[model samples]
Target chain A: MATQSFKTYFGRNSRQGLWYVPLLITVVGAVILTVYTDDFASPQNLSNLLSQAMPLIIVAIGQMIVIVIGGMDLSVGAIISLTTALLALDAPAFVLVPAVFAITALIGLVNGYSIVKLNVHPIIATLSVQFIVVGFARILRPVAGGSVPDIVVSCVAGTVFGIPLTVFWAVIVLLLGWKLIHGSRYGLHLFAIGGGVSSGQEDAAHNFGISDQRNVILAYVCSALFAALAGFYIAGRISSGDPGVGETFALDSVTAVAIGGTQLSGGIGSLHGTLFGAILMVLLSNGMNLANLSAFLQGAIKGAILLLVVSLQSRKKMGL
Target chain B: MGAIAANPVLQRAIRVPPAYLVFAVLLITLWVTKPQLMNVNVMGIFIRQVAPLGILVLGQLLVMRVRSIDLSGAGVLLVVNYMISSGIMGDVPAIAYIAMALSVGLAVGLVNGYLVGRRRVSAVIATLAVTVILTGIIQFLASGKPPGDMPGYFNDIYNTKIWIVPTPVAFWLLLTVLMSLFLSRFVFGRFIAAIGENPTASHFSGVPVERTVIASHILASVIASVAALVQSASVAVGSIRLGLEMPIDAVAATILGGVIFGRGDGGVWGPFFGVMCFALLFVVMTSFGVPDPGKQIARGLIILLAAIFYGLSSSEK
Candidate 1:
């Protein structure tokens, strides 16, 4: 009876004990870094690491929202590419930034329409959209040039009361994203839809609720918006846009989401877990570089870790 | 009956694929625009280049029919290509080299099959992870340098022609014919069809569900290895990179051949013709002097079209 109760409490669906693994990964990474590099303990090193993590963190946040709705948005990479291209354009910042954001949202809307109205699987639909958007980005800007103003870069790179400006902005985005996902009626529907669409629809019908179309749209919009934000940060980091910048974002974002304890089948994950996953990934990359590991071996290691985390989550889901 | 047979829509539905139709239209258009593009030799050469992709698609379609995918083609290609050019065999006879390469491929296939079929990992994720690991192993082994030369025998085989057609193209067609016979005539083929249509029902009927799936993956990976060999022989050297476009292209072409996830009754020959369509597409594009970036865009659009087509078909079903 005691074992049964203990199993019940610690079993797969429980969220209370979820923070342990991610926190462990983070602590282990930091300790290993400190041990390996003398400069790793310095404030500069920590700040630099956060800055490096900024883009992926933003993308992961967006990816988590989509995953929560039981779908993936592979088009996030294309959004990043498009936004980066927009940033590199010679147009004024006010025009360029807002236009890029709007364009990204529009692309998300198209994705939502195809998935919701046309009843397409998220993976295939988003993957196709990714291709189209990437094609457009290439056609529009074949060359990877143009620049972000130094002033804007300095502001993003600057610190507010010893906290990085990017960190502050990231916090705001995180809060807004969390509230939108966890607090709203839309959030409830998103989770429901992911759990099972037929039952979800029945539940919504009973409650005098509307279709989850709006939630789907919001999720994709958030994904594209966050991807664009990451693009802007990337622009600031490089002070220019390159088509190749987004080539790795799609795979890495998926990896981050998976490692975050989010089920690829959807509806069983958290932003906090995702944040942990992203940090773990960045730390692994940093550690690999520090250890002078070959890029291919690093890739192998990352893939192994991702496979392990996902398998653990899946096994738990399967009640194994 | 003759008029009905000649009707365009019936012709389309009964005859090969719309991709072939498009390929035909484009080929003719190019020929009319530039008569210089109508050489038989040029067309044969172009068809020969895409033979590897054609072979890979057979494996892809087989697995996809069972509601699985194999994106590990690129990794298999990388490793196999590397082995051929690495001089690892070091003066071993050609048959020995061939045997070793196929074994490596079959080993990889076995691993993928176990993970996906037995462990019940998501097909996309499992195959993709396999691909990543294989690619990494190849890259790690190769380090940063270009790979060494393929064996003289590999080059010799690649360069061989029977009559006017390339040996690889002939091999590709022979494999397709054999696969068609297996899928259409054999008991295992029937079992595959049954399993693909509905796994649970097939299992209840004692169709050896797990074994069928595992074998399908094994066959798919072996085909990919063959593709890698042909690809390496054609290039005469292996590099860190080879055929990243292949798995996705295989997906696209399979769909274009009307072999979507749920419906593959269109059979193996349809995708065989789809490979010809891709071959023709490259011919048309090159004839028009379309640049590399333009080719990229075209490929992207084709993939999108396949996805959209898949969406349309599935929703209707």
Candidate 2:
């Protein structure tokens, strides 16, 4: 009976997944970094770290929503790039900001419609969209030097009442993510749909009276919206638009979600786990930089980590 | 829509790979607008430029047939390019270079096969991670070194012609033929087809599904290495810039040829023509003065439209 309970807690089929494992790893990693590096414990460095990790955490939370339904979104990076470009245009804050959200929602709608209605595969659909979006972004900005609205820049620059404004951003984003992934009926429905899709019964959730198609579409839209939010934050921080700024976020967010113990096959993940995953990635990078490791070698190490983490989570299906 | 779906002729046309249609359309467009550029020598030069891509598509089609994919071609191309150009191998003979390149390909292929076939990881993530790792290592090694010149022999071989066709173009065609024959004549071909149709059914029917997938991945990686050799030879010097676009183009071309996950309606020649379409596309875009971003958008649109065509057709069936 004890073994059965333990298995239920950590089994491959468990809905919660082994999320605590990443939490444990994150704590351990943080402790090690704190001990080994003098700068890690400093207040300024900690604040900088929070800001540095905020965008990824925001993006990963959104990515986890789609992964829970057994779909991948490769266009998030491009959407982020497009967001910055749109924001950097010589326009008012109100117009530019709303326009960014509207454009991203439209992109998300097309992505969701292609996969859900047109029967295109998620990866291929989003990959094609990625190219198209990036091309448009390049046409808009071409290179990285355009000024953002003053209000946009100020949102990320200063502290609020002895605390960094980044802390407030994290709190807001995390609450929103938590509500979407853990607090709402839609979140439960997403897991139900993903559970069915991963088990080779693509219609299981639909048979249970869940509007699976709409939910899946919404998930993609949410993912895109989150990417846009991250792009907004990045643009504010940099005070400019860059066509290539978000190039790594798509893969990086995937890595963060996967490291958090979410099954890429779907239906098993946690918001806390994703938070820890993003933190772990940022921590690893920070520690590496402090250790004076070669920047190029850091990429290889991260790749190895991704491979190692994914290899441990075995799945039934073999292909893309 | 219902009427079109019910028509026999329309059904037959839908079943045909779009690559052939696109190829014909592009050929006519070129012939009509730029008749002078339609000569054999000019076309040969254009076709030769895409020989590496054409070769890469052969491997891509094989893996896609079995419902897997290999995006590590870019990494393999980069590593091989670095090896030949960086002179990191310490003054090796030509045969030694060939051996090293093949060995590297073999090693990468085995890792990919193990990860995707045995470990059952997502093929995209596994192969993409492999690419990142390889690219990172190459960049690290080539950090302080300047781009180096290629051995003169490679350029010489690249320029050679066989009966008015560039050697690389002929070689690409020869490989495509060999691939077609191998798929038609060997038991392995049957294995791949069965696995693609249904993995569980193939397993119950006593097919070695895992082994077959692994073998296909190995072959694909080795073939990608050969493509890399051709790509490296075409360039005069080695630089650290990533050729990530090549594998993506190969994926687009393969899909254009009617080869999606677990399907191969176009076979080898369809993708051969798909590569031909790309050659004409570049020429057309250049002559029209389309910028780089425009070309990127065009490439994306082509892939999207082609995949949508297959998706609709498959669903109808």
Query: Which candidate tops lDDT?
Result: 2
lDDT of 1 by residue, A86-189 (tens): 77887777788788889998988878877776666677677767877777778767878877766547757778787878778668867876786666877666
Instruction: Give the TM-score of each candidate.
Output: 0.91, 0.97
lDDT of 1 by residue, B1-317 (tens): 45665667755564344566666787788778877757877777888999999999989988878777788888888887877788876777777767876997799899878777777666666777777777777788888687888777777988888898889998998989998998889887888778777777887998887888888899999989888888888888778863457897897788778776645845887787778778878777877788666776677677666656556545544
Can you tell me which runs of candidate 2 are displaced by over 4 Å?
A1-13, B144-146
Best by TM-score: 2
Compared with the true structure, the alpha-carbon lDDT of candidate 1 equals 0.76
Candidate 2 on B1-317: residue-level lDDT in tens? 66777789988898789999999999999899999998999999999999999999999999989999899999999999999998878887788878878888898999999999999989888989999899888888988354598888998999999999999999999999999999989999899988888999999999998999889999999999999899989997997765568988999999998888888888888888888899999999998898887888888888888888988887777
- Error in Å for residue A194 of model 2: 0.8
lDDT of 1 at B37: 59
* Cα distance off (Å), candidate 1, residue B272: 1.5
| Local error of candidate 1 at residue B210 (angstroms) | 2.6
Candidate 1 docking class: acceptable
Q: Which ten residues in a row have the lowest lDDT in candidate 2 chain B?
A: B143-152
lDDT minimum window of 10 residues, candidate 1 chain B: B10-19
lDDT of 2 by residue, A99-147 (tens): 9999999999988988888888898898899999999999999999899
